[model samples]
Target: MTNTLEALTVPLIQAPMAGGPSNAALAVAVSQAGGLGMLAAGYKTVEAMAAEIDDVRAGTLNFGVNLFVPESDPSDPGRLAAYAAALASMALELGLAAPEPGPFSDDHYAAKVDYLVANPVPLVSFTFGLPSADDVARLRSVGTEIVLNATDPEEISAADALNPDAIVVQGAEAGGHRATHGQAKEPSESSTHELVTLAREYTDKPVIAAGGVTGADIAQNHFDAGASAVQVGTLFLTAEEAGTKEAQKDALLSGQYRDTVVTRAFSGRAARALSNRFTERMAAVQVVGYPQVHYMTAPLRAASADNPEGLNLWAGTGFAACQLRPAAEIVDEFRSL
Candidate 1:
């Protein structure tokens, strides 16, 4: 409750990577290593996420949970329908039927928030968008410290209005989905260094820099650039304890993926992912909706799990620095700086 930066011993945070990357084992390992480990609750049922939280508590007490603030508006059904048809082709190839588009759910925002409020954790961070002021107040009433993710100066200013305990300045170089509040808003092209610097100029709150940070050198660079700490997601993706799929793990290590690209093909919302066949095919065909596109591609993604070329292997610009080792060792590498 009202956790401080000191709750994170090494000032290194294991970024909350959703969609099967971040897991209890990875989080507990990072926390055990004297760093803050975060559980990604995006795309998970409230019950499943709570079970994972219980597991994390059993492993380590110092940890945080990150949630995706549900999209404010559902995507156009027609657009979602069209995207579904495109994904259906891949679904059929995988021997799976294409799922029909449905009304978008908030990924159980109310339930998850209520759960956390009733059973508070040491820390809670929000991404994709900021939580409602009432919800933020409710969590704070229970003494939970709130941290909001922001990608640019405007978003940082917006977060300041909520008076969060801390802010994560996510740069464009960040892996996974860009956390811009508006679905249609363009993400800033600034590097983590520049974003952190700009965010520092706007708010006095503790700023945690996220994106493309693979090692102590990169972490130190962010610290020097005015970040109080650095959040690294891709680095741990290759860690032995990470929940990253074997295919995704292979893709990161595969020299075949020479560069990472920001694409909306996989999840609709623009996110940084390893270049793959799916990304190439759906580049122009994708829609601007979030979980709708996210749900539409679910079947294709599941079917393509075996084929690394077809899956959305999310990674940052520093993916090449990823290593296959214990997560604690990965944390140590960043903490040593």
Candidate 2:
């Protein structure tokens, strides 16, 4: 198969919502429906990621796998410890032990890349940062298209320097963690359309616009602004094939979360999630740490999986348009866009 997203019948990609939303079934359903489906490898083990890859391959080869480009530990021990101490009360409420500064992790980036290199796929995308040129070349040699995510002009230029097959211009309005190259840096405030226009000045390579795509009209606007395709995440959270938790799915369609805010409360990285008790309570004390903070809050999240108030209700600005329906129907709305 060719290593380009242009092969898709529909110029839409299902955003890779890691943790729970994106999965084998959702990937298969979206790919079969003419849009590109993506598998998230952000918070999964090598074995689990590999298993899902095998499952998706069995159903379709038109899907892509997104990997979190490993970032160096930017967490200060003192800040982490302080944040953990702040979580003591919340942990107690959950009947769990106090939180601690969890160990740093690369999220197994090298091992997952090694696996993908050994077992090639149609496409691979990187977020947070771009992989080394050597790693990019290795994947390219196996006919796997390499795509990188960027949130601003500098990031776009940096990604273009890597000569990726494509670049995903994720706007600030995007749900989930902003794809800023460094965990410490703030994401650009540009809208998806604005970034899509700015991306044109950086590289002639295909630009895929992501963030706040809730309707066909929004997708069309991105295309009009020179995007080759648009990727939607929040809208797919309620899809029938999605692996989104019941509480989250219901919250999205229930009109409970009226607005989304960018906060570091959940994973210690700046991610846009619906305003809730956890976000409000931890907003001030939240620190700039990633996997460690992500790990530190695992118990709190696990204990409140069924409670939307305590969970990270990740959503885009257009989340109000989200509807619970079949994945194909969602993809079809953007067909031929």
> Which candidate's TM-score is highest?
2
Candidate 2 all-Cα RMSD:
1.2
TM-score for each predicted model, relative to the true structure:
0.96, 0.98
Alpha-carbon lDDT of model 1: 0.86
Model 2: worst 10 consecutive residues (lDDT sum): 1-10
lDDT (CA) per prediction: 0.86, 0.90
Q: Per-residue lDDT of 141-217 in model 1, one digit per residue for the tens?
A: 88788899998899999998899988999888888899999677778998888988898778988899899887788
Q: Name the weakest run of 10 consecutive residues (lDDT summed) in model 1.
A: 1-10
- Cα TM-score of candidate 1: 0.96
lDDT string for model 2 (31-96, tens) is 999999999998899999999999998999888999998775478899999999999999999999
Report how far off residue 105 is in candidate 1 (Å).
1.1
